[model samples]
Target: VSGNYAYVADYANGLVITDVTDPRNPQEVGHIDTAGHANGVYVSGNHAYIADWLNGLVIVDISDPSSPEKIGHFDTDGGTRGIYVSGDYAYVADTSNGLVIIDVSNPNSPEERGHIDTIYACGVYVSGNYAYIADERNGLVIADVSNPSSPEEVGHIDMGDKAWETFVSEGYAYVADQTNGLVIVDISDSENPEEVGHIDTYSALGVYVSGNYAYVANHVEGLAIIDVSNPSSPGEESYIDTDDLAQGVYVSEGYAYIADQTNGLVIVNVSNPSSPEEVGQIDTGDKACGVYVSGNYAYVADTSNGLVIIDVSNPNSPEERGHIDTIYACGVYVSGNYAYVADLGNGLVIIDVSDPSSPEEIGHFDTDGYAQEVYVSGNYAYIADWLNGLVIVDVSDPRDPKLAGHIDTDGWAHGVYVSGDYAYVADWLNGLVIVDVSDPNNPKLAYDMLWMTFYSVFGM
Candidate 1:
């Protein structure tokens, strides 16, 4: 809880509000019923946006945290899931319909701006004047959305397997390519995106790039580090074998924190890029899937155990500080003093990690599908769902998360990452997926790369 307001979308329960002036204690303020299942939420000033599954979009005025009133809505022809907001437009991931852009200048009356049909449209982000869409099997799609009402497809690149999510930075796009591992693309030219390099982890699900290193969460291979100093020729630098299946990874300082399936939380020292070593580890009993590090502590998604906090002041000896037992935790990311956990079947769980030794669950967002991975940037949390694809939620109000926008990539989304204005995803068998999340609400696909073969003759 950062300020005086908070919003949450409680799947079948609807949207809920709370006052979080006191980080330790959060009080529920209001609630609003939705026609369909609520999955994601976003709060902008006095308005709260929601991604209502079968019902499409739902808008509400949250000026009065205790009494939110519905203002307007727009129903997409297909299943409404993920969403993002930028400028005066809202980007939506409508199941099989690809990407849908809407004019939200009039909060109460959102009008369809434009759309690009693709495979499974999951998550989106807007950067500059372009939209990046995570198109599951199809890969990353970059669209020129200077004119929201007439968005145009500009470029695309498909990674071998299903692309669950993506993150773009410094003219490069890092993607989570399910079984194909992590892929890096050169998006310097949005209209002619190309695959500069890639690191295959066999079954990697999520990825994050910080500085010259890229951290990947390999389901069974554990955490992998790749040196991307040369974008056109990126190569695997090191590997931290957690033993347990790794799902999500986050880097802070010189350490890489990983979410391990059964080994719980595993911390690696990446200061030596060539010799990345496991510094600390903890077993949560439950399946540890996602992780994020902040200050001296590390937050982990302990699957059925909810959220677990560990002290990382001594990277070689991380001690369990606190934990919150919730439904099914999957992904986790930390910002400020709060740790956001993606609770698969339970939705989103927000906890106050101000006191690492005694963390507490402050709030939650119960989306319809089973949330897989999560990425936090600015004020939003992009969630990848196995069934529904990608769902974006506003965590400005840690306790009460609101739906901003969403995209439904047709495949089974496993992981997500945000960079610049793009979101990358790792879809099971679909390959690498990219989405333009610059607009936040309305994201579009740019490019895709299905399969690339490289052969070499040994003893000719």
Candidate 2:
């Protein structure tokens, strides 16, 4: 008996559901056809929402594990890509048209509420009464959405190049400014936002803020840690350089796990920020992209090799615990005893790691596009996709994972992270995106913006 399930939005294949209840025997469950190309999905209560490329938004009912039916949908002026739901509003990344807002008070009928047109909007997030938007070349934008129907832009930060992702904590926002690396901003005063500090991690992509540190997933630089004790003057404290190109990073216990492109899994001891050192490493012989650490084990997305597990009891000497080779693997995260692996082309793979030494493939799910990164919070797994944007999955039952909801931001999404009731994503070329996922199923774009800037003081 396996204990894993998955929901995938298989672009041309529609949305594919699989039962990984057994790692070696993943079986298909259900899928819903869409109007156009599929990009992402989200689930709320018993309904699943999808970002259907040109088709706009598609809603589906998934109360019954065996059957999924289309409920309602709406099309946007721009292409639909990433999405987030909060209260009764759905936020969509409408590509060049910027952020689109919709009303979903009635799951079967959605209505357009408002929209904020800006550069290349990619991801959106809502916190308190403000919304954060990732505006690619334009940088980070803060908007006052107390009036959801008429969102008003309040503050803006121009990050050079493209701002890929953004995460907010306390009073600061952490932004991934593509080639510029990680940028820290003080959003305490949304009207007059200021850049406090930044770490030039080369080509950084994703960012997550934990405690007093900001963890950046640098493409070829691995994981870079910066101290954020002073939101206005954050400084690089230490870094763990993996042998391969790195994409995503997650911190748990006292260690930092990295998804190393060619090196596979890399674990580091961050107990001492100034003296960060690689404690363990494993080569999966594949392009490892994202990673998450839990307890004494680390889970890695071994691109073509699927999911690779490694024991980190002895950080200095890690051993391969188990693996379930699948299609193109991208992102990975662990919750409790199960590990969720994002399979770019295949979808999502769930594995039981109760016995790290002998992991078991339990469930699987397909998505609408190329799965990029995944973040598990509460009972849902938020996925970032290249074409689909953001998809939500229900993991209440590890053995029977199901599509919960979805929203589309018209852009190429690369990574995702959940904080409080909002989910932040890294949108390649576009910028950092913020989405409201408090409702789990229906996500609405709350904010979007570019995450970097360049300035020259004439007097200085």
Candidate 3:
């Protein structure tokens, strides 16, 4: 509420407009529906800009308080959670979508202006039009995305994570700690992420958070669901047993897609998270180690089989749609029709999935070190190059993907997640290492938190 009227973006409901003439009694004056869940709102002279999670931005005209109406909307490829309006643009703290800018000169027709692709943007605060992003492992990052088309980072809060896997959601990061079970950190102070909670779960390999629930892919015990509403005290709400070993997990819609190593891809109905029931299963003919779901398809990193695509549109009955060959495909990231595969032996293998029935390798960049995980943002594809640290490749030219930059980490880089201008590396023995990738051409090491100090000083 910046002026006469107070604008509210409801998470469950839509946008709620209220008349706050008098502080004691704020009465609802007008309202409108927004796609997905409305997570954050910003008020301009007479317009209410809403940051609709997954659905993107929705502009509502409130010039006539009693009759607020939607004027325009722009869909974002990544998840949007927070927003801020300044001058003639709106800055959005979009997860994976990074920082998105919208030109709102015409209140009735807001259009996409510019964006900075990031893998883990916590939250965004704006002053003088410049956006301040709370970036997890990288800390606080100051960016001038005012010129939408060419956004750049001016400053950053550097720190580091022997973090196994990392996931960013609504200003917080959940990590599967092999040594600590589960670790939750608050990235609101982008420059200062503090450990907010932890839980023990024997041994954890991967983790995913949906709503208030954090799903832990336990190596030997299966899957563990934790209630994270109270970040300071995360409580285990339930646990479900799975076949073989659960190495990775991806939650989408109402199902938990698990990369059940050796056993292959396993699907469980999580609509009722506590009691997860196996609804579907796909034996990829190889060890399933990584999984990612998009639309109605499930792309799997079948260790020996290379890339295996499955049709999970029918959750209870998943069928193999296609398969492509690559060398030790361990991690994957799909964007549009291209599937970027982290081939340990061959390097970055780009497969054109325009036809899911037959994915073809269009291009590849043979990289150094053991490629573990990958995250694609904009034209760049980031790889956690084992001992090589962070490897940034220019993928703008899909078929001609080339190495744009590379940064060596302190430890063996096992996993990597990018948000905006920084890359959070899960450096196995070194812990979590944060690198500034704003200047992709010259990736510089910001800082790293070494849990195993002995390994930090000595080569492992």
lDDT of 2 by residue, 117-150 (tens): 8887766666557676767657767777788889
TM for every model, in the order presented, reads 0.58, 0.60, 0.63
- Per-residue CA lDDT of model 3 for 1-460, tens digit only, reads 5555677888768888887666446799887888679998878788888889988888888889788888888788777888878888888888876888888888667777888866676567665535766555454566876577778887664433224677777777788865567877775555556778988886777888899898888877888889999989999988888888988889999899999988889898988977788888888888888888889899999876899999998998999999997768898888899999888746788999889999999999877666788889889998887756778999999889888998877456777777767777777555567678989989887666543211110000
What is the lDDT for 268 in model 2? 78
* Candidate 1 Cα lDDT to native: 0.72
Q: Higher-lDDT candidate among 1 and 3?
A: 3
Superposition error at 424 for model 1 (Å): 3.6
What would the TM-score be for candidate 3 when compared with the true structure? 0.63
**Rank list by lDDT:** 3, 1, 2
lDDT of 3 at 69: 87
List, residue by residue over 179-246, the lDDT tens digit for candidate 1.
46666777676646677786666676667788887777777777778888887777888776778777
Give Cα-based local distance difference scores for all models.
Answer: 0.72, 0.72, 0.78
Residue runs of model 1 more than 4 Å from their true location after superposition: 1-167, 176-179, 189-192, 199-206, 217-223, 425-460
- State model 3's lDDT: 0.78
Flag the better candidate by lDDT, 2 or 3. 3
State, as a TM-score between 0 and 1, how close model 2 is to the true structure: 0.60
